[model samples]
Target: MAETRVGGARIRYDDVGQGGPTLLFIPGWCTSRAVFRKLAPWCSTLHRTLVVDLPGHGESSLPGMDFENATVVDILRSVIDASGARQVVPVALSHGGWWALELRRQLGSRIPALVLLDWLVLEPPPAFLQAVRALQTPQWRQAREGLFSLWLQGVSSPDVIRFVQEDMGSFGEDMWKRAGREVSRAYAQYGSPLRALSALSSPVPTLHLYAQPEDSAWLDAQRSFASSHPWYQVQKLPARSHFPLLELPEEMAARIGRFIDARVDVGNPLDRLAPSPS
Candidate 1:
């Protein structure tokens, strides 16, 4: 475990093993780098792994600012810069994939490839954006505990359920409110990650591993995007839960390992970099 001071926030991460192209892991909302604890070792054999805890979640500190989408990108960039990694393969889960994509959008070719694990991507309609904002407010937070836990029970394993419950009990109020507020702000401001990625002129080589029984909207979006851009590919994991990484770590790691091996081994090394804007 290590901490880096990125501006006012203290970003915490676990740097396991060493080598290249560096594999950076960004966990989803609510959970921290701890979520990747079981998965990192399998990947470390081939690539250096950095499992990070974004601000306001896990062991990192957010200081005075809110954790919006842009801020999330900034934190990831800071971590990459601090590590002196010239080229990277970002492996992200859930909402973390949005931040990873945003970073790739900004840095361009510095990013080599992306592994999206059951990530949610949608431009979100106007009504949905409004609804998201509404859910972010204090009123929703006041009424969310039971409903949220129940929702967790339906989608996650007993371990994940326990983790969520414990996380909520320990860092529930601030983390939950801040995450919801920031994600809503991101959708309202920058639109959905799917929209942003779809708009890219050159597609980043992406491998999306989604859990079975996925969100239809996400499936539709990724399918549409991949159909047009051959560089993108999507596969469904055998598992049905939201946190498949936790439920099936070995299978998840094997799938990720295959993607990393296949995608990174393409002929021209330069092809891995993002193309310059036209």
Candidate 2:
């Protein structure tokens, strides 16, 4: 466990392994680095890995800072610099994908690749949007619990279930309220994860790993995007949970390892794969 101060807030992270092009793991909203406990250590064997607990989550302290995009990116940049990593591959989970994209936008070539886990990369449906909006109202707790139920539809793993229940349960009302607004703000800014990826100034070798087959439409959208964009790819994992990291960490690590070896270990691989836009 290591710590760095960003904007007077203490950010905590785990720095492990040793090599260039470090794997930086960013957990989703209201979740801690513990979400990456198994994944990060496994990746560390292949390359240096840094798993962070964003301010106000896990062991980190927020003090007076707001948990917005810029603040999160600043903390991430500080972590990368403190670890002396010249290059990074952000393995972001859920909403953390937003921050990962922003970090890449800020750092450019320093970000070699991106891996998104179980994020809604397409435009959300009206019901989904409505559910998120409800999180800002007085009934936020009920709304959050309902969303959690939906996300855990097919999850049967005891560990995964307990983690989600406990982690989400641990947040206070203020944090939940803030998370609701931040999520809505992120969508407003980038439209969707697909739009954000497309808007990148440079094509980044990216992968979206998901486990929800119930939403066939969302899965199909991801496949469609990946089919057209050589720099992007999507894979649906067999895990029956939204939190595949907790359910199938070894498999996730193996998949990520293969991606790094094939697309990122080489020099400018996306250049050879991604055609120049006319």
Top-TM-score structure, candidate number: 2
Span of ten consecutive residues with least summed lDDT in model 1: 269-278
lDDT of 2: 0.83
TM-score of each: 0.83, 0.93
- Write the residue-wise lDDT of candidate 1 on 145-220 in tens digits: 6535544755647766765567545565666666667767666665766666666656788888877444576677
Rate residue 120 of model 2 by lDDT: 81
Cα lDDT for residue 219, candidate 2: 76
lDDT of 1: 0.71
What 10-residue stretch in candidate 2 is worst by lDDT?
269-278
lDDT of 2 by residue, 1-278 (tens): 78889878889888877655678999988888888887887887867788999889999999473567677888899998887677789999999999999988999888989999999888877887888899989999999899889877867898788888998679877888888888899998889989989999999999888887566777787778888998998888888888888888999999998888778854543322321111
Where in model 2 is the C-alpha error above 4 Å? Answer: 266-278
Against the reference, the lDDT scores of all candidates come to 0.71, 0.83
Residue 75 in candidate 1, Cα distance off native in Å: 2.2
Candidate 1 vs. true structure, TM-score: 0.83
Query: Over 4 Å off in model 1, which ranges?
Result: 65-67, 123-131, 142-156, 212-221, 265-278
Candidate 1, after superposition: displacement of residue 178 in Å? 2.4
Counting clashing residue pairs in each candidate, in order, gives 1, 0
